[model samples]
Target: MRNVLEAKNINKYFKKPVLFHVLKDISFEIKRGEFASIMGKSGSGKSTLLYILSTMDTDYKGDLYLNEEHVTGKPSVELSQLRNKHIGFVFQFHYLLLEFSVLENVMLPAKKLAQLSHEEIEHNAMQKLKMLHIDHLAKKRANRISGGEKQRVAIARALINNPSILMGDEPTGNLDSYNAKNVFDIFKQLKEEAGLSLLVVTHDEDFASKTDRIIQMEDGHIIHR
Candidate 1:
């Protein structure tokens, strides 16, 4: 199978405040339909690596490919388009607009994408919510839902674009164990059932252990995979 994401010889430096190296000689690939996690302690640079992989941090030195297309050095506008089309993101916080309805929040990404008609976007958003079992909360205000429900809404929003890869940064860091497991199971189902690729940075050992592969990091370097 083709790789969904690949990084070759990635190196990053924080030029300010003493010019420190934050990531060193990192290289990895996440294949289509695979589920993986990055695990490390604070200051380990796992989240930094994830940001690069997500195409949001373009200051690093290396080659990055998404779905076999070389993306390194692409113009920011082009990268934004590519990211919107192929990458889904779920962060530690839901970051939902509190006043919007859940359906509107879920539809926001697709609206920004603007590749589909209004009817189609709404239909797709509802489909995603239904898939996540959060359709019942669609008309409710985003802030009115429980934390777990809010996260589920976020997942639905991420999937609305049918992205080639889903990326998460400490996605469960703010959730309880039950909600964390729920998120994990949702990710697993998305992999097994929908054939989606996922790369998540997490500190939870149990969460890391359950994924198909764990890329362990230490002091800006990948120590294991």
Candidate 2:
């Protein structure tokens, strides 16, 4: 399979009173339509790696290739556009707007794309929400839903633009075992149904095992896979 994303010799450092290196020469490749996991303990730099891959943070040393295009040191505006069009993110928190209805939250990214009419965006949002089994909550305020529903809404929002890659940071961290399992199942379904490329950061061994491949991180470095 062709690679959808690749990282070469990635190194990230944080500077304060002193310098702290968070990632040291990290590298990996994700194939199109593959489900993969990055597993690590707290402070292992998994989130940082995901942010770099998603173009959320670019002040790092390395090369990133997305869909065969080199993406290091690109202007923020360009990076933002690329991210919006090709990448989707799901954080540990749902990060939904409490004031917005579930459908509205899902429509937010489509609105930014500026390619779809309002009606078209709404129709697409409803379809994605239905795919996640959250269509019944589309009219409800995000804050009024259960944690599981909120996370599913977030997933729907992420898929609104039909991104080529889905990057998740501890997506099930806040849920109970049952809900976490459900969320993982949803990811599995996404891979099977949509052929979505997924790279999830996780601490759970069982959850990581569910993916096609697993990369293990330790102290800001990829130790093994």
Candidate 3:
């Protein structure tokens, strides 16, 4: 299988009151179609690592590669373009536009990419909503929905651009056990059917164990893979 992301000797530091090393020589590879989780305590720097992987944080001392392209230290504009094309993000809080209808929120990324016409973008947005079993809520205002529904809608929006890798930062954190499982099942399907790589930063052990692999971290270092 092909590797979708690779990190080599990644190191991140902070210099405020005192110099500190947040990440130390972190390295890992995620293969295509894999559903993997990064697990650690609150101070373990898991979120920091995920942020760097998202291509939005490039101040670390290491090499980062996505889709076999060396993306370390790339310019902001290039990283922005790369992120739009190859990455999709879901946060603990589903950051949907409350005033907009669910369909509109999902279509925003596709519209920004502008690779498709209005009609095509609409169709693809609906397709993603249906795939997540949220098509029935497509026309409803985002704020009118429940938390679980909002998170599902966020996932749908993330998929609208057909990103190669689907990333989640505590995607199920806001949902109850039932709804959390519901969202995770859809994630598994996305990995299985579309061959998309999934990298999730989460604290739920039950959820993490079900994924293909769990990369455990402690004290800013990977403890297990």
**What is the RMSD of candidate 1?**
0.5
Poorest stretch of ten by lDDT in candidate 1: 105-114
The candidate scoring highest on TM-score is 1
Return the candidate ranking by TM-score, descending.
1, 3, 2
TM-score of each: 0.99, 0.97, 0.98
- Which stretches of candidate 3 lie above 4 Å from their native place? none
Candidate 1 local lDDT, 142-181, one digit each (tens) = 9899999999999999999999999999999999999999
Number of colliding residue pairs in each model: 0, 0, 0
Local accuracy of candidate 3 as per-residue lDDT tens digits, 1-225: 888999999999988879999999999999999999999999999999999999989989999999989999889998998898899999999999999999999999988888899999999999999998889999999999999999999998998888889999999998999999998899999888899999999999999999999999999999998
Model 2 has a clash total of: 0
Tell me the tens digit of each residue's lDDT in model 2 across 1-225.
Answer: 989999999999999868999999998899988999999888999999999999888899999999989999899988988898899999999999999999999999999988889999999999998898889999999989999899999999999999999999999999899999998998898899889999999988889997999999999999986
Q: Candidate 3, overall lDDT? A: 0.94
Off by over 4 Å in 1: none
